[model samples]
Target chain A: MDKFLCGIDLGGTKINTVIITNKGEMVSSYTLPTLAHEGPEKVIQRMKETVYKVLEDAKLDVSDLEGIGVASPGPLDAKKGIVLNPPNLPGWIDITLAKILEDEFKIPVKLQNDANCAALAEYYFGAGNRTKNFVYITISTGIGGGAIIDGKLYDGANSNAAEFGHASINFDGEKCQCGSYGCFEMYASGTALANFAAKEIEKGRESVIKDIAKDGKITAKDVFEAYKMGDNLAKELIEREAFYLGVGIANIIMNYNPEVIALGGGVANGFDILYPIMIKTVEERCYKASFEGCKIVKAKLGQNSGAIGAAVLNIVFSKN
Target chain B: MDKFLCGIDLGGTKINTVIITNKGEMVSSYTLPTLAHEGPEKVIQRMKETVYKVLEDAKLDVSDLEGIGVASPGPLDAKKGIVLNPPNLPGWIDITLAKILEDEFKIPVKLQNDANCAALAEYYFGAGNRTKNFVYITISTGIGGGAIIDGKLYDGANSNAAEFGHASINFDGEKCQCGSYGCFEMYASGTALANFAAKEIEKGRESVIKDIAKDGKITAKDVFEAYKMGDNLAKELIEREAFYLGVGIANIIMNYNPEVIALGGGVANGFDILYPIMIKTVEERCYKASFEGCKIVKAKLGQNSGAIGAAVLNIVFSKN
Candidate 1:
């Protein structure tokens, strides 16, 4: 009999649930707004609803699942399956979501940080396939990453390995929210890109970015839109973004020396366009030998990476 | 009979060789000037002479040895036993020192980068003892490091893992020889400290450092001496050096999250003086959870780390 696995990607804005074959073939999936402002109870209730609906739509019972995995923003206790306080998911303090889900469904459950899950997803089914040393980086509102060393997730003391976002790129530069000066995320993330665009326009620089941002609140996506229209300011911002990403990636190469670095998330959606410039910067910053040994590519799983990796956690870790 | 292992630390200015029991008890040691300008052939001959002297002093023969381990500056091919163009040892391109030793001794030989060897030595007998996740950082004329992941040395894809010195701390800052801008070494190394002091003196800041360097060739040691004499310039330079180290170490914490970060090398001779400020900066930069989970300390082995680690390489890897 074929075993099915259930995965739940818990986010600040939504809950994503999926029931898939052990091989990652999606049988049924469901998504719903979290309405998290209503509190943990309401959000978890929605999460459970999606899980049950996904199972039902797949014509499967709770017993059919190998196990359930939950991927969420961390500082959480992976071993205890508790969600620690995450900046994105405000007020989500020490909630045992894994236990809550397990008790309700009467099935086993596991939990891990979303970055680690995404890394696992890529290693098993995406750009990291067949590579023993791998790293997955997500450049969304913030930068974060997970490393796979010798074919296993490198969960550093307290599951905090590969928090590359907080690593500073400028010792005397901008102060970051994390109490660091010029952190990688502060320079290269989508939020940083948008903030840079806004700061530039505020300086009276001419650009389509301001015109495109009708309500006057510019987004990183707006910069990309303007870039397509041949706006010089937009082009400059994107180029700098690529350069910053390269700088951070070069540091990552120094740290892990992985065989492959798979980039995912919001900014990485522009990966193909950014790759050449980004790689050129990397080549300039690192040893020819180290850079040549690695293959940098766009992450394949995209938005579903977290859910897919979450689903595989119990399957991979338990079997080991 | 106890199994005996031999280790050699090949460096730009010197060659250090050691004989140790499998349990890491030292039996004999020898050192020789490298005179690297004379090239690889002469350097290798001296290396062989040291090996013979160490064995003779220990009252052991080549037949009684387990295997030989050679630790050198990298860009070398460890698997192929070839020394590939290390900048410190000029003209050392593709020299098969390991094979030459093996052929002469009729015993197995192993090779690794010196930084990795130091990490392994620390892991086996120094500050990293009983720790699974460890990192050893050496801050000298330049900075370098090696990581132990899940109780084993992480060699990465091409023996270049943990080259943390090259990682940029400021994307728009001073250019480094490695082509990166504002590398950790460019700001925090012993050489960097001396250079900063020289620059400050050139700007006409009054200090005992000028008197200490009678030949007008400033050294990091002179700055430390000036610091003891309460030289204001030296004090400021030391503080900034500590600050730069803190910034780099903060990034290291983000990248590896090791339980222990044992700092070694020339700059680290003053680790106690630098530690408090460095840790304070790290505390200010990283999350409370991660900071609490790690223990930072001065490396225990000091200069002998590389040679000791080289001796244990074959023991650790082959036994596994």
Candidate 2:
């Protein structure tokens, strides 16, 4: 009987479930809206249904499954497999997701932060493959990151390491939601770009974003679209955002000196505009010797990175 | 026969040598002026002499010695054991210190950056003992740092990881010597304090620093002394410096989430004045859960940390 595994990538708005063979070949996968307003129990019930659905579609019995993994937004305890008050997920206090799933499926279950899962996915199958040490950063609605050191996830003293987005790049720049000032996410994340465009438009700055927004509420996509059309304000805002992103990357280089830095997420994927300037700034700012020959590249895995990484967690730990 | 080890801490102004038993008992130690103006060849010769002297004083011979370790200021390659243009060691470029010493003594040699040595020493014998992960920061003329992850030193791809002082906290604040803007060292280091005071005096501001500095050039020590006497300007300056220090510490917590953060060096030792304010700022900025139970304490080992750590390098690697 060939063994199979399951992975769940859980977020506030959605849940992704995947079933794969032990060798990492995907058998089946599915996505579902979380309906978080219905509370943790309901969401968890939906997750169980998704897992069963994936297993059934792959024509695999529950007995063929070896383990399960979950990638969750966290400030949670990975060891205890508990979800504790992540900012993205509301009404989830101390839910022990791992134990619940383990009991439900009668198999081992592992829990890791979403950023860490993304990093692990990159390390094994994406841009950071074969690198002993690397930093994986995701620049979506908010910035999230993880570090792989010596080929293993670095779960800091309290299992809350690699909070890269919260590392303040400007101590006096602006108040952040995380209680810090000028966090990289506040200046360079997709939400940050949208927020900046909205604020500027509210202040009566002339720009095409007003037309793109339709209802006068700008989005990061609108800003990018405006930049593509040669809007002067959009160009300036993006330049400023790129400068801060570069600073954040430079800071990571100085602090971690990882073998590779793989950038992913929606904002980073605006490569035609952001990648060139961000790379140039990093080269100009980081130590010459350290940056020389160091690889700074786009992440290879797309939306599936989180689910695949989550699934691989059991494989990695079993090998260890 | 019992084995012995030798450690050399080489700096711009001085050289410290020590001989210890395999079990880490100090047998003999000595310090001498570096005489760096004599060039690398001469300095290497002096280092050889110092090692021999320590062995002789400890009543040991070449047959009893296991290996030697040297900790030096970096920009050097630890893997290659070469010194490559450290800022403090002017005119010394691409000096193969480890190979030369190993060839001379016919024993293995290990080379590490001074800050890393300090972190290693602290890991085994100081504040970070028994802590699986920690960050060691030195706040002297400039900031320096190293990290110990999973009970081993984390030397990134180029062996330049944990250049904490160079991590920028302000992207557009001020230009740094390393061609970056607003480095943490530029805001929180002792040199930064002295420079700030000098600039204020140059601006013709009213301050007791003018009286404290007979030569019209203020030092960090001079500012501290004036603050003790209740000078308003000194108080304001110290407050600003403490705020930046707190910001740096907060950033470290967010980025690494280490179990402990050990602070050392001249500026950090002035704890009676800086600790309260610095702690307050850090608590106000960092994620409350991550900071909980995390020890932010003074480094246990003093000036000898570098020498001791260097000697422990070979022992650590040999065991591995």
Pick by lDDT: which candidate is best? 1
* TM-score between model 1 and native: 0.97
In order, the TM-score of chain B in each prediction is: 0.98, 0.95
Clashing pairs counted in every model:
1, 0
Let me know the DockQ for model 1: 0.86
Model 2 reproduces a share of the real contacts of 0.76
Tens digits of per-residue lDDT for model 2, B63-168? 7877888999988899899999987777799999999998999999999999999898888888997598989999998899999988889989877889889989
Pairs of residues at least 3 apart in sequence or in different chains that clash in candidate 1: A169-B169
Model 2 DockQ vs. reference: 0.75
lDDT of 2 by residue, A1-320 (tens): 66887889998789999987766677999999988888899999999998999988998877887788899988889888999988777789999999999899998999999989889888888899859998999999899888999998887866677788999998887898888888989988999999988888889999998999967778788888999999999998898878778989998898889989998888867766887788888887788876884788889887877887888888878876
TM-score of every candidate relative to the true structure:
0.97, 0.96
Worst 10 residues of 1 chain A by lDDT: A311-320
Error of 1 at A15 (Å): 1.0
Which CAPRI quality tier does the interface of model 1 achieve?
high
